[model samples]
Target: MHYRLEHADLSLILALVRGRSLARAAGLLKVDVSTVFRSVRRLEAALGRQLFEKSRAGYLPTSLAQSLAEQAERAEQALEAACVSLEQGGEVISGTVRLTCTASVLHVLLLPALARFMPAYPALTLELSTSNDFANLNRRDADIALRLTDSPPEHLVGRCLGTVSYRVCASPAYLSTAALGDLERLAWIAPDDFLPDHPSVSWRRQRFPGVVPNYRCNSMLSVAELARAGLGIAVLPDFMSGEQQGLQSLADVPPSYDTALWLLTRPDCRALRSVVTLFDELARAIRLGHAGGIPA
Candidate 1:
């Protein structure tokens, strides 16, 4: 056939393949779900090949589509490597790159990555805003945001780092004495009334309404510390606990609610080389499992 696939076509295919869902692909491509759907239909018609099979899980790519995606990924990697090469060639990368995320994210995930990142890019200054509230990217409140939500903002373009699963955890010292099957009977370290809408708090309310927490803290970091100190069992993201922190999971908290972690930025802001550079660096660190299996 004489048909030719454009870069856009390859990118669309690759995004769909990697993202595994129209919604996720749309998020990564910074387009509407309808746009991704239409592009898939158009591509299939032109190429005369089935690219994906839709299932309850997500889009499953065919062998042909997978092969094409592999090629697209190589192209993407080459471009990124070239960018890094240029940066290393003494290309001055200056200006502030502001980022916002929750305090827990800073302590458990972003800090280790940033510790290594800051020293390398001396010219690049970073303004780290730690807040539970989502910063308004539309108003340019921040250059980038690492947010945990099922629905990321449509105006921003970015990648879903990964899904974060919650676990009911306590220090081995606490778990040794606590009853495992009767979770409600156990002493609980919970989010404060200030965070009534938090997933863990809501989960507790729904599942064990009569269970009063022994410790309540607005800050997840504090809650974690309280749990680590063997105060009570706390529902925490798996990244926060586990063998590394001397915590053991007593039960698995359902991830039926908000879980997806996204790294988002304004479309126009991506045009800035420094912003893109930081974005790439953070993304790289997360995917490589710098902190935990969050990006895996």
Candidate 2:
């Protein structure tokens, strides 16, 4: 007996192959663990072949299953290409473009560009996922990812928009009453313990080991808000230090992280008009706004 595989089956196989565990597969497919377990059992019964073997490590795919997954990946790529071709002929672009970026980037950079882009392309729907963690594009987690990094992943295609500069900033109110002589004496708002590995946080710890934070936050935007409220001084991206925010830079302690602003997306996703439009618009707006974006 012969069995035909549907798109869902193909996706399931690919996710399983990549994820190597039921939970991870479910996460990649955006489904529950039971769903993945049921699908695997169903596929095995329908095809009359074992796809994966349960091991102490995880779900290990058989050689036959690996081959099927490879074919499925190719099919998915072809489908994406076909969709892109069909979309290109149409004058109006309509589809959801998932963008993953840090909240700081959204607040300082993306919002202005999105405000204008949304009006121009009324048919397009934009979904923004704000997180410091990089979204996995290979599993279709997000169509586009905006990041600040020294090196971008080789798998994705994107443009390095420019350097994102960092600076120590505080409200004028906080600075006025504060002692100017000793930097360690000032109240500092630091990145949370969870983000100890964050470049800014690491930099602060190294530069001023004695400076204890009065407050801690994980989100860069929140840290900036605390600084703006005269709570404490914080290291913030240059874009956040806009004159309108009434925050002045502490020129005495200048620190820079050698990272570039990158707009990245999978090669297959780049062909879609929604992704292409937003990608170009962002690159243009960021470059224009920051004017070379202050070299890192």
Candidate 3:
């Protein structure tokens, strides 16, 4: 505790909490595991406490680790604040922001927001990836992730931008042309990432009993299209739900439903220059329903 916690020390604590192997954590840092191990050993020696207890599963935290995590998180945040001061002479916030998310959210909500941000931070570069998997932030697959889940993995900092309502929707022409709406007659569009296990899907099933989706997809963008082309009714987020030109929200079915979109990053990463500035901008974009982020 005599020496201040460094960025590497903070990263080590978070990696261990995420339960990745020592080798995996080392690979993430592009260093050998022994070096990381030595760093931990050195830190422990400096603190005079056992930080981790080895188990078959992985290293589990001791009380000292828990304490260190809290202190380290604070230290990292303070360090990042110092970096913000350094940005004064740079004229622009310049750094690469790696973002991972679903395509629909990316296209519909995120892009619009970035449009505004990029102008202000001319030197900031945003590299976006769309995937269902929660991209590994600890390993730097992406610097930030926007996800439609309530809680994020431990050691990551999560902020709730807001929620997007879910509604069963279809094209108006399709609804008028087809003799559907009997609740038992229409086929549903199932997207892989936002699947049956998701609460939105559960809500749909509850609203319309005994109906199953015949068309399945892996992305919300696909499902939205399928519904727009009159394939079938699909349960979708409000941002995607309202934007489709001909779509009609099933007024009677379910109105009181919502899914939250969370902005997440490793706590230590949140303190990094690129991560904090981007997060602040991204958080603003999400709240404003900019950046193709679906409306809450």
Highest-lDDT candidate: 1
Q: Write the per-residue lDDT of candidate 3 for residues 179-217, one digit (tens) a residue.
A: 664745876786764555665567766766676678888
RMSD of each: 17.7, 9.0, 11.2
Candidate 1 residue lDDT tens string, 87-174: 7885566667889988889888899988877787766768888777665566688898898777776767887777777888999998
TM-score of each: 0.65, 0.65, 0.62
Give the Å shift of residue 160 in candidate 1: 0.4
C-alpha lDDT score of every prediction, in listed order: 0.83, 0.80, 0.72
Kindly report which residue stretches of model 1 are placed more than 4 angstroms away from their true locations once superposed: 1-89, 136-138, 288-296
**Among these predicted structures, which one has the highest TM-score?**
2
Deviation in angstroms for 189 in model 3? 1.7
Question: Candidates ranked by lDDT, best first?
Answer: 1, 2, 3
C-alpha positional error of residue 276 in candidate 3 after TM-score superposition, expressed in Å: 1.2
How far in Å is the alpha carbon of 44 misplaced in model 3? 49
Q: Could you tell me which 10 consecutive residues in candidate 3 have the lowest summed lDDT? A: 287-296
Model 3 ranges with Cα > 4 A deviation: 1-90, 192-194, 243-245, 252-257, 288-296
lDDT for position 172 in model 3: 74
- Please provide, for model 2 over 163-206, each residue's C-alpha lDDT reduced to its tens digit, 9 standing for 90 to 100: 66777888999988898787778899878976777666777888
Q: Which stretches of candidate 2 lie over 4 Å from their true place?
A: 1-90, 252-256, 288-296
Model 3 lDDT vs. the true structure? 0.72
